[model samples]
Every structure is written in C-alpha cells, then in structure tokens.
Target: MTETTPYDADRARFTRQALARLVLCDHAVAVADGAAGLVATENDPDAGPGGRVSQAFQLIELAERALVSAVTYERERGSSWAEIGQYLGMDPAEAEERFAADLDGWNTAFDVPYRLDDTGLKRVPQLPTAAYDPVSACARLDTWAGNRLVLVNDEHPVSSGLTMAAPKP
Candidate 1:
C-alpha cells in the first residue's frame, strides 16, 4: 500500500507558508489572529505534505475555537478523511489508519462519526437526501468567489451564542 498523504500538493505548500508566518509570531492570537493562527501552527518544514494529520488536527481544533468564529464547526458534512481519501481513490479504512493518528489527542473531548448526510439541508430540507454533496457545493462557491473566500460549510447546533475563556499565555 502507498503511504498516506496528508494534504493535496497545493495545500501542503500553502500550509507550509502559513506555518512559517505563524511560528515566527509564537502562539499569540492577538499577534497571530484569524488565518494567521492557521499559519502559526503549520510552519514545521519537517512535517512535509504527508504530515497532514498534524495540520488537519490543528484546523479541527481552531475551527472549534469561539474567539475565531463563535461556533463549533464540523466539516464532516463537507469533508472527512475517509471521504477525501475515497474521493482520491483510497480505501476508507486504509485512509483512516494513515491519518487517524491525531485522534488520540483529539479524542480527549469527542471525535465525530463521519456522516454522509445530516438530514438533507441539501435538498429535502429536513430529510436526508441521497443527492446532496456538501463538498461540491462549497467548491462552486469558492470558485464563484474567485477562490478568495474558502470555507467548509457545515451544519452547526444552534446555540444562544458562545462564551470564550481568555487566550492561554
């Protein structure tokens, strides 16, 4: 079997650049901020493209951060390792084994089951639809936005809002 790849070639390169910026600023969000925070944790050249588990886990972490978006987001509806791997022509079980290493740390809280659909927000409104594809939808939006506004659209549990603790020192 081929070794698991972490991210696509372009993503790996972009992440390398982002991480380079992020590391220089240390771990300060005020100094780092938004996409900068993403860049911060990704700067390890030692990681390489095949080290995407590290990068994906970091993104999984930051997406849940409230100060960043005030809402926990799960791209499971849009993207998952198994799903991505399948799209890339790999076995789901094998794909998971290669990149699921980060689950040990992330599992401390909760790790979501990959869902093909969370009741069809795609077509049936409240029922799961066989035809919905979140990844494709987001891809179109990104293209329409001139590739400037990239996002992983997903369903969120509605809350009154969120409360955040002070950033760690």
Candidate 2:
C-alpha cells in the first residue's frame, strides 16, 4: 500500500462542511468589501446615486450567495431539514427540495474537481476558488478570522492544527 502523505490526509479531512464554510467566508469578505465601498461612495461628491444603488444590488446578490453557502454548511454539519426549514418559514421537505440541487452540486464537485477550458489547455475548478485551493483558503481565512477575533493572535488562528500544506505535484 502507498504511504498517505500529510497533504492527502488533510485533503481527506477537508469535508463538505469545511468547503462550504470556506465558500461562506469568501462571500462574507466580498460582501463586507462591497458594503464598505457603498459607504465610501455615500459621501463622495463624484459618486452617482445610480452607481451606489447598483453596488447595493450587487451586495444583495452576494448576500444571497452567502446565505446559500451558510445553508450548505449547516446541512453538512448534521443539521436537520426541519431545523433549517423553521428559519426559512417553510416545510422541511420544501426546504430540502429547494436546496437539493445545490447540495448535489457540492457533493459532485469532489468527484470532478476541474474541467478543461475551451482551448482544453486550462483546467477550471468546479469548486469555489478558496475551496479548490484549500491550502491558500486556510491561510487567507485564518488571517481574516484572526484579524477580526480579539482572542486570536497567531498564524493559523482559525485553521490552527490543520494540515493545509499544498500537495506535491
């Protein structure tokens, strides 16, 4: 049998919940940045109301994506459909049915990590950029979390003890 390297082990341990959380974190960062931009433009004499409204609309879209990711994360963490449905004010079956496709896609991504580009020269990852590159995701997420959480101060604060080294080619 072949020896299992640290990277392989880490990758194996990176469950669907972890991937969903990474996606959520990425979306959260984008939403935060977009909100900041909207605030900055609020008082800018050169910024138009129409542009600010457009930016706000984009932020709303991002927030919706983040909500989806949050649901995915919760499902992966053993949350019951009823529990999730309660928050959305819908039946459990309806809630599950609504998110079924997204859940299926998330599961399928692991089986088919990437696809060829039109030229067949470049491979495009099926998972979100952060989830696809878990090593970088861990680092970036840890930094972001550490900066936000007062109790955390070290490198890998969020992903501490996780083996997130890049795989050997």
Candidate 3:
C-alpha cells in the first residue's frame, strides 16, 4: 500500500504568492520603461540591447531572493532536507548547496528577523502603490512650501532660501 502525504497548504500558498510577486516585479519594470519610452537601440551605445539584459538581471535577482526566503521559511517550519530536496527536484545536500549563496546574500542584505521577539511578532513591510488622496497631498505641499510657493513641473525653477532674521525683542 502507498502512503500519501497531505498537500502542504502553507507551502502552496507561499509559492503562489512568490510567483505573483516575481511577475509583478517584472511587470513593474516593463511598465516604467514603457511609460518613459526608454527602449535601448543599437544606435545608442549607452542604452544597449533594449534594456533586456538589465531587466533579465533584475528578474534573476528577484527570483533568487524569493527562492532563498521560501527555503528559509521551510527550514524554520521544521521541514526535513529530504522534503525540501524532493520539492526542489534534487538530492538533499545539493538542495542546500544550491541555495547557499543566495541565502547568504539575502542574510547579508536584510536585517529582518526570522523569529518573533519577546513582545510579539514583527510587522510585515508594505509594498509601494499608486493610491493617494490629492487633497491631503496638496495640503502637505502647501505646508512644505509655506510662504514661498514652488510650482511643480513648471518653467520656473523650484527654489529654497535661508534668510537670517534678527531676534524679536
């Protein structure tokens, strides 16, 4: 008789989320480059190969980060090397070695803690979004500008000056 292990809900969910994030990362670069019309051409030596090389590098970096994080999460959750290896389609030792450099790089770059502190769990960081209230933004702009109004995206240059004033009696 064959014994089947139940599907891991957490692993499945995390894998889905990681893939989504990777897609979003690539999409974001494409969108921004498209909007700016910053396509690299053969004529321009500075912007080589339609920015494809750079975009590919970015994608690779993002993928590495996600893979390392997921592996770390699995390890923290008490997943055995054999299980991780099976999921990665490799030998147990090879699986660990494959992710070693990426995991080390991630550890060096980010100071984020894997475990909870004495008080409680750490908060998840928020991703950037386009959502904003213009009213509040304008109010903040007014406060920042004060008496000297700075026109945004206008011909007139936005300037700031520091003036010394005598102490009031």
Best by TM-score: 2
Clashes of 3: 0
Model 1: residue 68 alpha-carbon error in angstroms: 19
> How should the candidates be ordered by TM-score, best one leading?
2, 3, 1
TM-score of each: 0.22, 0.78, 0.34
Which residue pairs clash within candidate 3?
A: none
Q: What C-alpha lDDT do the candidate models reach, one value each? A: 0.33, 0.76, 0.43
Candidate 2 C-alpha lDDT tens digits along 11-41: 6657666767778888888888788787664
Off by over 4 Å in 3: 1-48, 100-169
Looking at model 2, report the run of 10 residues with the lowest lDDT sum: 1-10
* lDDT for each residue of candidate 1 in 76-122, tens digit (9 for 90 to 100): 22346555566548876765664454333233222221223567342
What is candidate 1's TM-score against the reference?
A: 0.22
After superposition of all CA atoms, the RMSD between model 3 and the true structure is 20.0
Clashing pairs in 1: 18-39, 19-42, 19-43, 22-40, 120-127
lDDT of 1: 0.33
| Candidate 1 steric clashes | 5
